[model samples]
Target: MRIKYSIPIVFFVALVIIEKENNIISRVSDKLALKQTPQTPVQSSRSANTLPKRNVSVTSQGKLSSAFMLMKRRLEDYSDYQPAAAVTTRRKNILLLATTRTGSSFVGEFFNQQGDNMFYLFEPLWHVEKMLTLETGGTNATAAAKAYRDVLQKLFLCDFSLLESFIDPLPVDHVTASLFRRGSSSSLCGEAVCSPFVKGVFERYHCGNRRCGPLNLTMASETCLEKEHRAIKSVRVRQLEMLRPLAEDPRLDVKFIQLVRDPRAVLASRMVAFAAKYKNWKQWATDTDVPIDDDEVKKLKSNCNSIRMSAEMGLRRPEWLRGRYMLVRYEDVARFPMRKAAEMYKFTGIPFTPQVKAWILKSTQASKEAGGIYSTQKNSTEQVEKWRFKLPFKIAQVVQKVCGPTLKLFGYKFVTSEEMLTDKSISLIEDIL
Candidate 1:
C-alpha cells in the first residue's frame, strides 16, 4: 500500500513541474517577440558601408548622454520592468521616412501587416529625438544617440528583469483598480490604452523595460517561425531628424519609404486640425510650445518648407547609403493603394499576403476621409486638392511664395494665371510634394 501511494504522488509532482516550466517559457517567449528573428548567417552579413552622417557635435553628445542616463536611471526605478529580446530582431530595419501629412501612417500600417512576425513602434521617438537645431536650445549628440538606443532597446528587447526589481510594490490590481478601471467609461482596455498619460507610460514600458516583453512573444516566435521561418521585420515611423543616423547604420537592413504630399493640402489640414483642437493657430502654437511668431503665417510656411526639405534630404541619402529606399506619393496611395501596395511589398522583400490586401483596403478608406493618414473611418479623397478651396487666396499665395522653390523641386508647378485658376491651377507639387 505504501509503494502504490508513492507512485501516485510522483505523478502529481511531475505535473506541477511541467505547468511551472510552461508558464516561465511563455513569459520568455513574450519578451522575444520584441525583436526580429535572426536571418541566415549568409543573408545577414554586410559589407563596409557609409552614408552622409548627421553632423552631431561633441557638445551635443555630452548633453544627449546626460539626458539618456537620467531617463535610464528613472527607468531602473519603474516597478513593471520587461526587457526587449532578440525576437524583436527585425530582419530589415524599415524607416517610414517622410514628412508629416503624407500618407505615412497608412504605409506604416501596410508594412506592419506584411511581417506577421515583425514588431512595430509607430513614431516611437519623435518627441524626444526630433532633429534639433542650435536654435532649439542646442543638441547633445552622444546623449541623443544614447536616448535613441534606449528607445531601440525598449522597442526591440524584452528582458526587463532588472527593471522589475525597481518597482515600488503595490497590490496586484492597484493600477487597474485605482487608475485604469475606475475612470474608464468602458471595460475595454482601449480606453486605458488611448489615455495620453497612460499610453505614454506603457509605451515607455513596452519599449524600454527589457523584462516586460511583447504582447505575445512566445506565440509569435514559435508560431511565426514554425510557419514561415522568415526574418522578423520592424517598422518605425519617424520624421526627418531621426532618419539621418538610421540611414547610415550598416548592421541594420534599412529601407526608407518616403511619402510626399501637397504642402498646400498639408497646411490646410493642419490649420483645421489645430483650430478644432484650439481656438486659433497662435493659441495652438503656444499650447504645443512650437517656436514660431504668433501671428506670422510665414512661420507656418517655414515649418512646412523645413518638413519638405527634410523628406527630400532623407529620400536622397539612400543614393549613397548601401540600403534600399523608395519614394511614394501620398495621392497614389490614396487613389491606387492595392496596385502600389503590391509594388511596395515587392520592394520590402515581403510577400503581399491576402491579409495585407484586406488591411490596405481598410487603411486607404480611412485615410481618404480623415484628410490624414491615421484615421479609423473613410472620409474624402478630394482632400488631395483641398488647399485650393480651403486656404484663402492671399494665404495660399504666401505659401506658394515661400515653398515655391522647394515645391518646384518636388514637381509642383504653381498656377500663375488667375483666369485659368480652375482649369490650369494644377498643383506644382501634384507629382512629388
Candidate 2:
C-alpha cells in the first residue's frame, strides 16, 4: 500500500510541473505578440494590412524586423531628396532669352558665378544658329524649328554627346575655353561636393592635356545630373512662341527670363557697330548680300519690328505664361543691380545667399569702371540714358517713330527732337516710362 501511494504522488508532481511550464510559455508568447504590434493606431485599412498580423510568432517577428531595418538603411542612403517647397523640388532649368546686345551675357555670367551646383552654358544655341546659317536656303522653317527644340531638350538634359557634332576647338584664351580648363574638379565638383559618378568621371578625365582639351562628354553629362541648377542663355530664340512647347512639357521645369533693352539704344548701338564693320553703305550691303537700297535705317527698322513682336507676345501674358515668364529690363538691372538680382533669384527659386550678393557688388563695380563691347562698367544711372546723347537728333527721330509704340509698351517715354538736340533731360524720360 505505501509503494502504491508513493507512485501516485510522483505522477501528480510531474503533471503539476508540466502545467506551470505550459503557462510560462503562453505568457512569453503574449508579451512577444504585444511587442510586434505597431505603436501607432492604424490610420487606414490599407495600412492595417501592412502591419504584422495578430498571430505573428517570435521567429517571424525577428525576420520582419531585419527586413524593416534593411529598408530603412537603404532609404537613408538614397540621394535626391529636396527639403524646399514642392515647386522647387524638381531640378531647376532656366532659359535666359534676349535679342543681341541686350546685356544677356552679363546676366548669364551672374548665373555662372553662382558657385558650383550650377552648370551654366553661355549661348549653347549659337551652334544651332551657325548650322541654320549654313542650311538657310534648303532648310524648312518648321523642320528647323523642331530641330532647334530637339537639341535644346538634349542639352538641358545634360547630354553633351550631341555637342561633339558641333563642338569646334575654341581659342585658348576664349572665355568658354578658360571655363573648360578649370576641369570637373573645380566647376563640376564644387569644392568636393559632388555625386560618386561625377567624382569618378572627374578623377578619370581631369589630367594635364585633357584639362583644357575638348570637354569630356561623359563627365559633363554625369555632372549635369548631379547639379542643382542648369542654366542656358540664348539670343537665337526671337519669338516667345517658339518656347511654348518647352514651357508646356510636363517632363521639364523651365523658367524664362525675357531681357529687354530700350529699342532706341539697341538701334543706336547696332548702327554704330554695323557702320564700323564696313567702309561704306554699299560695301556693307554687298558684304551682307543685301540690296544696295537696304540702308542702315531699314535694317534698324527690321530689328525693331522683330523685337517689338517678341515684346508684344510677352505683353499678352497668354494662359501658358502666367507664372513661367518674367520680364527683366536691361536698364533696371544696370541701375539697381542688387535689387533686381534679388528679384531674379526669387523668381528662379534660387537662394540669394551672401556669396551671390558679394558677386553682384563686385561684378557691378567692375562693370562700372571697365565697359566692354558687350557691357559697360560706367555708372549704372548714366548708362540708362547714354543712348539719348550718343544718337543724333535726326536718327533718334527715325527710331522713335519706328519703335515708339513698343517703347511706350515697355514704359519708355518718347523723346522729342528739341529735347534731344538741346541735350535736355526730359522729365518723362527720367522715369522708367
Candidate 3:
C-alpha cells in the first residue's frame, strides 16, 4: 500500500470511530437544530460540504501527526453529515371541493391571493372532464373519479405534463395555450409561468395585466414545484369520498375543504347564472308543477345526496382524513369572509398572509360586482341575501322538498311561502348544524 494514500484512509476510519466515541454526532445534531428556521428545513448537502480551513502548524518530524490532525478536523466537520433528505420540507396540498355556484371561486381567492408562496389552480380538472367526456361520453364524477384522482395526485406533486394531453389532444407535442381558467391562477400569470407581452408575438393570450404566448407547462410546473403549498379548486368532484386515495397517499399531505351552500340559494343563483341549463327550473319557478323525477330535478337531488354523504364522511373524521377535512358553508363564509378564510388557512396548515387578508377586505366590500357571475370580487354581505329574493317560493319549495336532508344537515331554515322567502328580516340559515 502507498503510505501517502493508505495513511489518509486509515486516518479517515480512525477519525470516524473517534467521532462516534466522543458523541460528536450529538453535537452536530444540536448545531443543525440551531440552524433551523421556521420556513426552511435543515441546511442542504452543500452546507455539509462547507469545511473550515485548518491551521497546519507542525514541524517536518511531525508531518504524519499534522496529516492525522488535518484528517481528524475534516472528519469532525462531517461528524453529523446529514443529507438534505434527512430533514425534508413537508408540503401542504389543498383541494377546495364544491359544486358549481357554491362561492368556490370567491373562496378560492383566499389561496390565490397568498402571493408567490401559493400555487393555485382554478378548475384545471375542467379540462380533464372535457377530455374524458369527449372520449367516454360520461359526465358523472363516478365514471371519472379514478382519472381525476390520478391527475390530481400528479398535479399536487407539481406535475402538469399529463394535463397537456387532456388540454389539447390534437397537438403532436401535447401542449395547449388553452389551460382552463389559466388567468385565475396568480402564480401562472406571474413572470415565472408567463413571459411579458411581446408586440407581434403573443398579442392574443392576455393574463390580466400581462400578455404572453401559449402558457408554457414546463414553466408552470417549475413554478408549482417552487411553491411550499399547492391548492386546486374544482366544482367537478361530486363527493369527498372519491378523494380518499389523495388523503391517504404517503407522498402527499392533503386537506379537503368542502364548501357547501344552501341548495335553495344555489338553485336561485344557478337559475340566473347558468340560465340555459336552469330553464326548466326557471319555468317551474312560475308556479308550474315540478317534475320530481325529471333529470334536472333528479340532478339537484343527486347533488344534494352527494354533498350530504361527503359531509357525513368528513364529520366522521375517518383515519384517512386524520383531521384534514374541513366542511365550510358558503353562507358562513359570505357572512364572515376574513374569519372563514383564516379558519380555512389554519385548517390547511398554512399562514393567513396579510396580503390575503387585505384582498378579502377589499374584494368582499366592492361597491359593484365585477366580472358578473364568474367574478371573485363582490359585495358578499349583500350578495348572501340576494338569492332569497331571486328564488321564487315555488322553486324554493321544490329545492326544500328535494334537498330537505341536506338543508337540515347544513343548518338552513326552511321557508313555507313566497312572503317568507322574500322577507328581508327572516334568517334562512341557523347556526351550523
Q: What is the TM-score of each candidate against the true structure?
A: 0.52, 0.64, 0.77
Candidate 2: where are CA atoms >4 Å away? 1-87, 137-144, 168-211, 272-296, 367-371, 375-378, 421-424, 427-433
Question: Using lDDT as the measure, which candidate wins?
Answer: 3
- How would you encode candidate 1's per-residue C-alpha lDDT over 249-291 as one tens digit per residue? 5644555566666666666666766666325543533354433
Q: Going through the candidates in order, what is the number of backbone clashes in each?
A: 55, 4, 0
Superior by TM-score: candidate 2 or candidate 3: 3
Query: Which one wins on TM-score?
Result: 3
lDDT of 1 at 76: 28
Across residues 1-433, which tens digit of lDDT does each residue of candidate 2 receive? Answer: 9998999999999999999999799568545543543222222232234333222122221133321232222223222222344235457788888887777877766687776667877676666656666757544445555666777788788775554454444322221232222332334434332323332232323323222332445666777788888888777675567678887888777878888887767765665666664244334323544342345555555455555455444443455764566677788788798887776776777776677677677767674548566553445566667667666566556666555444544555555555644464453232331
lDDT of 3 by residue, 1-433 (tens): 5988999999999998998977777556444532331111111222123222212232232122322232223223321233333223468899999999999999999999998788999998888899888887876455677778888989998888667667753433433456777788888889876754445543233578676666767778888999999999998886676788898899998888889898988888888888998899878877578888898887777677677666755654556864677778898899999888877776666778899999999999887847588888899998889988787787788888777656665667778778988887978776432
- Candidate 3: give the clashing pairs: none
Candidate 2 local Cα displacement, residue 135, angstroms? 3.6
- Predicted structure 3: lDDT: 0.73
Task: Indicate the worst ten consecutive residues by lDDT in candidate 3.
Answer: 37-46
Rank by lDDT (best first): 3, 2, 1
Q: Which residue pairs collide in model 2, if any?
A: 367-377, 368-377, 411-433, 413-433
Query: All predictions: root-mean-square deviation over Cα?
Result: 19.8, 23.7, 20.2
